[model samples]
Target: MATVTYAFLCSGVGLALCERLLSQDTERLRLCLACRNMHRAQAARSALLAAHPTAQVDLLQMDTSSIFSVIRAAQEVRLRYDRLDYLYLNAGIMPNPQFDMKAFFKGLFSSNVITMFATAEGILTQRDGVTPDGLGEIFATNLFGHFLLVRELEPMLCHAGRTSQLIWTSSSNAQRSAFSLEDIQHQTGTQPYSSSKYASDLLSLALNTHYNPQGLYSSVICPGFVMTNLTYSILPSFPAFLWTLLMPLFWLIRMFTNTFTLTPFNGAEALFWLFKQKPESLDPYAKYHSLTSGLGNNYTQPRKMDIDLGTSESLYEKLLQLESEVRRKVEEKKKEAQHAHRHLAGSVSS
Candidate 1:
């Protein structure tokens, strides 16, 4: 029997994974639902317990946008649990998403939206927002925060197996082209969400290089474009609702086409598919699993690009530097906190 923890970001997706894992066997998997919101985390916990009354479910606040939040969450987990098997970096956001109208309509006719998003992908976000950390929200949630979380929780994650796996919930929408080397946050007129996702893809690949030998295995998952709540942000709310009504048909088209995977269950195809294997055996070619029409319903298709070992390595090094700097900040704050506590205690005694 194997003990596993499904560490995920999104409450909905995390719950979905928990439901599937729990349905199998109660004693096999331990679930820790880490979300940005505590109220939502409590609600998710209640729902999970309602279904599986005896499930080992715990809730912790893991806001990836802030390094402090990540460090705090890691500390909380250390206080409670011992070893962690799976670290699913499944929390990401396309904040203030805006569809490229020109590309959408054009892609609809050419049926290229599938390949376009998969291979030479491009993202259009004509909107603006900022995170509490002051970095671009999309970048912070999608890449940087996860980066910090991985750094903070390295000790637990490395305890999974002789070869512990770091699973990154990446996407086919990740574009090597849209991502700029200089501006990772997409400060200029670029799609920051896509850039950040691309950065993560590169970062994941990079992690495998440096960490795989250290008994840590890293793999990135392309959860083909599932009709997640995250995607609804791009369109007018009503229109998006109408569009979802036709989503099944679009999925049907993808059944035969190898380029697609439909539904959250299906979108999770790659994540589930990869779970059956050892991390050391992962395809360096970046094994992509998809569903095709002639295939009935299977996740065994491959597209080009999204596997740059070099870029991945570069991103990994960059994150290491960021982690060092962030940890220093945490230690300084801890020292200040201790100083304040000492002063307060002295005043109390006086």
Candidate 2:
């Protein structure tokens, strides 16, 4: 049997998926946890090894918000593995979240109450910043960095005969209104998180169109309302006890909509389900959702996304152009650093 290698860019749901995969079969499976924090990654690896002592779990230090970090990590992956079966783009951020209490209260009495609770659609917005790469922090961390990583790992992913999968952990909050083609990086938006996620949805479709022929398949999944690090940040002021107190209300809300897959394990349902499926057999146009019923049953469901081929293609071209520009900038910066180092060395010698 061939060894299947899985690389994950998330911690919570990704770890849940890792546990599921190991539980299913530890033999001939290589799992790599690519994370920004080495300490946390090491802890996750230790925990996984504790559960399944014989499992192959490796860690790669990667900050998806940084361009050079992603490139270097991709290079390391190429050095370590000849074949990568799955790449999970699950790292994301929602910085400085500002909850609209008025809207939340109004929605409670309105017909959109379920939608508000299910998606957090009109109730939340975020303040975004720029990364050192001159890209929006949320955009870089959530979408572009993953895009660059995939581009770098194209050789391993698009290999002949065998098929590989690109599974993106998108969101139900990914609104079509939030994303703007003109401002792809979402520079002028308070909802950068939504825009970034929406971009991922579009990019997945575009990737499918381009890479499917090369035995590479791409799909998007919504891990609806999972209480991960990202969710915790939304209401940073709320204590853990307060959140615990709201459990009953949350459960009551879940009775109305199955989108409240609150736990990380439950949220990973769709991602884990996709793993057992044949890449070619999946629908490229649909966004798979992780759903948990009121009776606590977890299942995967596919929902048609509000996306068009023309827009997806356009986004693809824009990303290609942006990638080229970013690459050129990186090269120029490298040369400048080299010149600075040489100048300092000459001064010391003199």
Candidate 3:
């Protein structure tokens, strides 16, 4: 039997979903840990090997936030493997996150408390910035960069006889109202994280529609309220001990809604579940959520996403346009640099 190849983009050390996924069946799986930080990637690879010495784990360096880095990574992937079975678009960011204590208190007494916690509707906002590529950092890191990677690796992903799956780590916080086609990058918004996630859902649906005939499948998942580095940044003012003390309160909230899958292992439930499923058997319109019950049992549930085919297609087109613009700019810069180098060399010789 051919071994299954799984490439995870931006695998977090210790709290990564890839670690749990690899632990399940390391011998049969060829794991690729694609991350920006070589130090963290090496650490993650070591930890995985330590637990399962026989596991086949490889590393690729790529910062999903940078367009140039993504291009180089795609080239490396093409050279390394002929075909990729699963591409876990799991890397994401929420820069300068600020929790709304006032809104949290008000919502506690309101009927929307559960909704607020589950979806983080009015209780969370993030201050986003621009990337070196001149795109919104959150949008680029969370959505467009992955989109570009998928586009670049289309040959491997869309095989004639076999199917490849793109599993995106989206969120329950992805609200329809947060996304705007007019401002797709959320350049002027305080909630770029939410906006970008919503865009992922739409883009997934679009990918299925466009590539299903060619055997490429796309699906999105909500790793429900996982307490990773991203979550820790939200309430940085709260000491680690204080956050640990609030575990009971969070557990109590879980009884009302099971979306609070706090640990990365629990949050990865849907991602692992998707691995065992047939891509064609999945629902494109649903956002698969990783839920942990009050009893601490973890399971994957699919909820209908608040996106339509029309909107998804529109977003897909917008992404294509942005991709073209960025590529063009990159080429122009390369040419300018080459010209400047030649001029300097000529002057030096003279």
Best by lDDT: 2
TM-score of each: 0.86, 0.98, 0.96
Cα lDDT tens digits, model 2, 60-166, are 99999999999999999999998999999999888989999899899989999889887888899988898988899999999999999999999999988889999
Q: Per-residue lDDT of 22-130 in model 1, one digit per residue for the tens?
A: 7777787788889888898889888878999989888888788877788789888877777777788878877666666687667757856666544434435645467
| C-alpha lDDT (0 to 100) for residue 247 of candidate 1 | 73
User: Highest TM-score among the candidates is held by which one?
Assistant: 2
Give one digit per residue, the lDDT tens place, for model 3 in 75-131: 999998888999999788888888989999999999998788777788889999888
By TM-score, highest first, what's the ranking? 2, 3, 1
- CA lDDT of each candidate? 0.70, 0.93, 0.88
- Model 2 weakest lDDT span, ten residues long: 225-234
- Which scores better on TM-score, 1 or 2? 2
How far residue 179's Cα lies from its native spot in candidate 2, in Å, is 1.0
Comparison by TM-score, 1 against 3, better one: 3
